[model samples]
Target: MYQASKQRYETMPYRHVGQSGLRLPAISLGLWHNFGDVDRLSNQKEILCGAFDRGVTHFDLANNYGPPAGSAERNFGRILREELGQYRDELVISSKAGYYMWPGPYGEWGSKKNIIASCDQSLQRMGLDYVDIFYHHRPDPDTPIEETAGALDLLVRQGKALYIGVSNYSAEQTVAIAKVFKKLGTPFIIHQPRYNMFDRWIEDGLTDVLTQENLGAITFSPLAQGLLTNRYLNGIPADSRAGRSSSPFLSPENVEATINKVQQLNQIAQNRGQSLAEMALAWNLRQPTVTSVLVGASRLSQLEDSLKALNHLDFAAEELAQIDAIVGK
Candidate 1:
């Protein structure tokens, strides 16, 4: 009963994942927060459909995305079965593992057992045979880099995943794993890091490593988990992410620390004829290695607003310098 847009690809841009042949939409949808069972199924469907209608073909997920665990994938799987299954090849779906899932020792981390099992569980939940990209959510301090890399390599060999990626890894850790992946001939092509105007840690050394290894980066929390948006320009609304007691990453003190800079950034965005959110997302895409900007949109309007970032991805030298000065470069 659902129809896709005839002009879906009219405006959206797709960027290559490093040197790989694959390309992802510049603005990919992330089901990190609101696609779970706690949210309305109707809202979720609307957002997903709206994204695809705008040419967003990639959807990022993880095993532990739901508060109840695995609910986001289930809900998305239902949406796919009923609405988008016919377009499976046109979509690039990714899921990650590394957080706690079950209770036993094999329940989490980057071990061969946990990684493979988590991928299987994700595939089952989504009613799919293989995901486009599978990621190890984070580095395990205890696991050897070779072992973790081996587990991911095995996923591709077993036909459970097409490409391998890692999230929240350091430059050194990435290089270590890349070595093993290269030897095993794994198609490890992407890295997901928490990057934003406020959080520029990826710029330190990770960007260089990614460039050298030819591994693309898709950034998470590009808006500093909602701080770079207009939601907190005046004050944190009761419904805003920072106002929620559950996600303490953006506490009142954190918002206070960056409010001045955020306001300045908003002014620059207004000058560029974009909202703060659009400018913030464009800032992340400005990085050469960032193949896509992965963000969560609970509503269709938010997704529409985000898609506007593509309109003005270019920045003047003075604008860049002003942003750097405001964020204390």
Candidate 2:
């Protein structure tokens, strides 16, 4: 059985996930980069337990998170069965689909068949009767939005998912989907998107719509896939994600520009008594609609350090200004 920390909630600040009665920890753990079949199961379990002991009540996942695809959820399924079954009500486990999974038409995209079947597969992978929230990983232009929304509604009614969400949606798309969920009487609880000090795509418009519609926003890659951290300052470490993986997002050209921005942001974080990663996490939460900043760590220490974002959330006006200049918008 899992013995959670007595002061878990005392250190973390739980924010309302938009207008919903549910509140999530300001910093949530994401299993996007780690918890794969290739990684040591013991290490993965340690990180999971370490996160919970430190008050990370929300765990974010996707069908394609693992290198082997779905392995992350499968591993987490074992953890849930062996360690977290007793604490189910104390945690919010969310999973998303919409990325390619299997062969044929039903394996990917936002079709009703895909959404429903993905949820079913996700439940089996996680070994749970219902996930706290189920999301369409991204918008599919070919599929009707109404059909996608209908699939989410059907999941809720079928007791497979408690709430629904959409990820990587534009401001216009978010509003449009919200309307569909509204008509279907489904609670669209949250929106997941990539956001960080170096990237502010949602600030221009998407966040505004979330505010008006009362949908919670959980910012993914708040550390910009570790670009915003101190890891890339001197040079990319041999163990860093950029050095190990082949990602279109973290190229050498991007690293050069990001280095300059991170240097500036690092100074701002120092002035605020926080590390660069902590400040990066806090920066996303400054937005009123942002309920949580989803972070992924390769180690337990990194997860612990990231949780310090809740230590001090206040931001000086000049600090905000400096961040804006660094981000170039």
Candidate 3:
């Protein structure tokens, strides 16, 4: 008996994916961290519903998102079935396959067998007939690009996915596979890259390729895995991701290396009347080729804070230059 806000679409902005007919909200919800078996279902429902109420129509997931693997999809599927089933057509649910999922050789990589089988398994876990956009999680050095692109095209033909994308691909890799997808007549629409003020690798060449190829780009980790947020300004909290011993990505040394830069950036964000997180998210969207930014929040308040970045998406040239100087861009 949950009701979505009638004013959901009033505040959120939607942009077309490249030159395609599909569009996505400026901020898409990413279920990478909190929507897992270890988390409570009620909390998950609350966050999901809160995001939808604010016009987050796209929910990004992957086959290996959960620590236990596939748990996030199972949890999200239950939430969809028990709470938001009525809003299925109104939402764009995306899932990717490219990381480790199972025990044997067929479990990982971008081979034809792995890609197709992973999509099927993801669909089953999510209790869905078709996902809006399915992505190849990463490039497989051992597999032929042709096989991977062919598998995605096959998924579209089988009616399992509407559009296709690739994540963590370089400019060269994207151009190579894009040609194959173009020849196959696959509706390859988007590329998911890790981009933020701290990570500028995509700007080196990927953005140009995406723009040239007319492919939309959605950036993951737009907050630089929480480094761009205010959480670490005073030092890492005992409960924060950086404080956790098991977190492979954010380490104490890494935080120490970038803490001063983060503090400097915070001052700039304060001058602009925005939080560090808001400015970070806005920075990624400044690129016209970037269709959307994928963000994950453990609570409704965090999500609300992220949505505020839309208020000041416009940045002066001086501000951009200052940011680049502070981050050593």
Candidate 4:
């Protein structure tokens, strides 16, 4: 019953993932939060619809994305069935394996058994025959890289996934697995890293490797888990994620440590006629190796604000310098 915007593609930019034939929107939606079972399905549907109508063709997910695990995929499945099912071909839906999803040993890691079973479970939860792209959520220190690459290759061969990717991999780990994927002739296309103004771990070496290997990079947490946003500019609001006592990742101490830098960066964003979140996203996409920026939004308005980053993607040399200085680069 929902109609996507006829002009959806008009304002959005698509970039090729490294040298791959596949392309992703300049900004992709990530269902990392607020799409789980504890959240309202109606709100989830609205965000999905809003994103699609705004030309967000890619939706990133993982088996462990929900608090209860698998709930995000289930909710997305229902939305896909009820609303966006007709536009399946026009969208690029991705899901990840790795990370614990069940009670036993088989529920986690890079074993062929875990990866294969997880992908199947994710497909079932999302009610899909195939996902556009599938990722191994993180590195397994004990598992042989060959075993994991083989599992992904097997998925592509079985038609369960069109392409394969890895997340949270280091530059060295990426190179190692990319070799295996190359030998297997797997369509290993992209790497997802946590990158933002504050987090520069990828720049330490990963970006160069991605460019050299011709693999695309999609940086998640482009807003640094909302640290780079205006949400904490005036101190943490009780309703915000960092303010919530339940959140272990973003604590008040964490905000206090970074608030000074955030405020300084905010002034630069205002001078550029954009919001801090917008500037943060633009900054990540400034790297050519970065094929896209993955952002998560809990509300339609937040998604709209993120989309506005595309409007002013250019940064003067001085602006970059100032940003680097403020964030202690």
In order, the Cα lDDT scores of the candidates are: 0.93, 0.88, 0.94, 0.93
Give lDDT tens digits, candidate 4, residues 1-329. Answer: 99999999999999999898999999999998899999999999999999999999999999998767899999999999999999999999999989988888898999999999999999999999999999999999999999999999999999999999999999999999999999999999999999888889998999899989999999988887788988899899998888898897788888999999999999999999999999999999899899899988889998998999999999999999999899989
Task: Give stretches of model 4 more than 4 Å off.
Answer: none
Candidate 2 CA-lDDT value:
0.88
TM-score of 1: 0.98
156-181 per-residue lDDT for model 1 (tens digits): 99999999999999999999999999
TM-score of each: 0.98, 0.97, 0.98, 0.98
Point out the worst 10-residue segment of candidate 4 by lDDT.
Answer: 240-249
Between candidates 1 and 3, the lDDT winner: 3
How much lDDT does candidate 3 score? 0.94
Q: Candidate 3: where are CA atoms >4 Å away? A: none
* Model 4: lDDT of residue 190: 96
Summarize candidate 3's per-residue lDDT along 15-86 as a digit string, tens digits.
Answer: 999999999999999999899888888989999999999999999999998757999999999999998999
C-alpha RMSD between model 1 and the true structure? 1.0
Model 1: clashing residue pairs? none
